[model samples]
Target: MSLKASDLKVGDTHSERLVEDLKRTQLVQYAGASGDYNPLHTDELFTVKVAGYPSVFAHGMLTMGMTGRMLTNHVGDGRLTKYGVRFTSQVWPGDTLDSTATVTGLSEVDGVKLVDLDVVTVNQNGVEVLKGYAQARID
Candidate 1:
């Protein structure tokens, strides 16, 4: 959907699936793509035996990147000026991520329109994985 700053109102929301039934292969692929080759992300044995976690979990940046994908998909590309998130929980295999962005503020600066978004991503169990805010220019 094309969203204009002038047309957006506080509380307007956009939601989409970020990832579904997350798998080990996807994590490995992400590791390759991002060069994050930490064994904790790609090697279950290292994660469970060495790191002492119950199981391997996703890399924080991978989740953050997924959040970015959700944001761009909702509001369109090249508009995001600022986007950030706090990693709140581990995303394990088999978890599905549902992402949402709510319009929180709107403003204009030097004739540039801006839209502020409150963004969040939650797992299938409704546990928040990432939460943050994003600001984008609306052309």
Candidate 2:
């Protein structure tokens, strides 16, 4: 499902629901898989009492990964040449997330077509949690 540069424009977009009612179990699993066991992510007691957050929150990387999945699903496997993001807000249990990738640029560099995308992930309330950009090879 490679994107064709000729078929895309700067404002074209693709979106996906990344998660629904995010669970603490999913946070713990991501902690184990990514080796990021910060109490802010998995320790509800510490997060509330000691860390002073409302609750254990999702890892920024977890949200970023979900956003990346949206990008890959839109751009095709192994097509990404660059990707980067900034975590804008905390994601907590029970939050549903939706991600979007909007084409920002299209060009042919050295005869290879490429597309630049602006990526964003927002929670159920429409608060952005992750924002980034990606560049990928296209058909």
Candidate 3:
């Protein structure tokens, strides 16, 4: 459900499953769609044999996009005013990621109701993979 200014409290929280067992093929598709075919994302052999990572990992943008999807699901279309995130940890294959947002502030700006949310995304092991904030118009 979309949030209204009156419906939000400082600690109100919402979560959504962002990804289940993130796949290499999905990473390749994201690379193709976003033109971010960095070898680190698409090349497992290179990453493991050369770069020394156990396997290829998901892109930060992919995680951020999933967080965006969570916000959109909560706020509906065209309601977001500002959103940004910081990548905190690597997201690996076979990890389930969940996006969560907590209401942080509520105010009226020029007669428009605004809601501020603290956003975070965590992997299956409960490690924060992304941290961010989003502001949206709630009418």
Q: Which residue pairs collide in model 3, if any?
A: none
Error of 3 at 106 (Å): 0.2
Question: CA lDDT, every prediction?
Answer: 0.90, 0.94, 0.92
Model 3, poorest ten-residue lDDT window?
A: 1-10
Best-matching candidate per TM-score: 2
TM-scores of the candidates in the order shown: 0.96, 0.97, 0.96
Compared with the true structure, what per-residue lDDT tens digits does model 3 show for residues 1-139? 5677766789999899998999889999999999998889989889999999989999999999989999999988989999999999999889999999999999998998999999999999999999999999996
Q: State how far residue 11 of model 2 sits from its true place (Å).
A: 0.4
- Candidate 3 deviant stretches above 4 angstroms: none
In candidate 1, residue 37 scores what lDDT? 96
TM-score between model 3 and native: 0.96
Clashes of each: 0, 0, 0
In model 2, what are the clashing residue pairs, if there are any?
none
Off by over 4 Å in 2: none
For residues 1-139, what per-residue lDDT tens digits would candidate 2 score against the true structure? Answer: 8998779999999999999999999999999999999999999999999989999999999998888899889999999999999999999999999999999999899999999999999999999999899999999
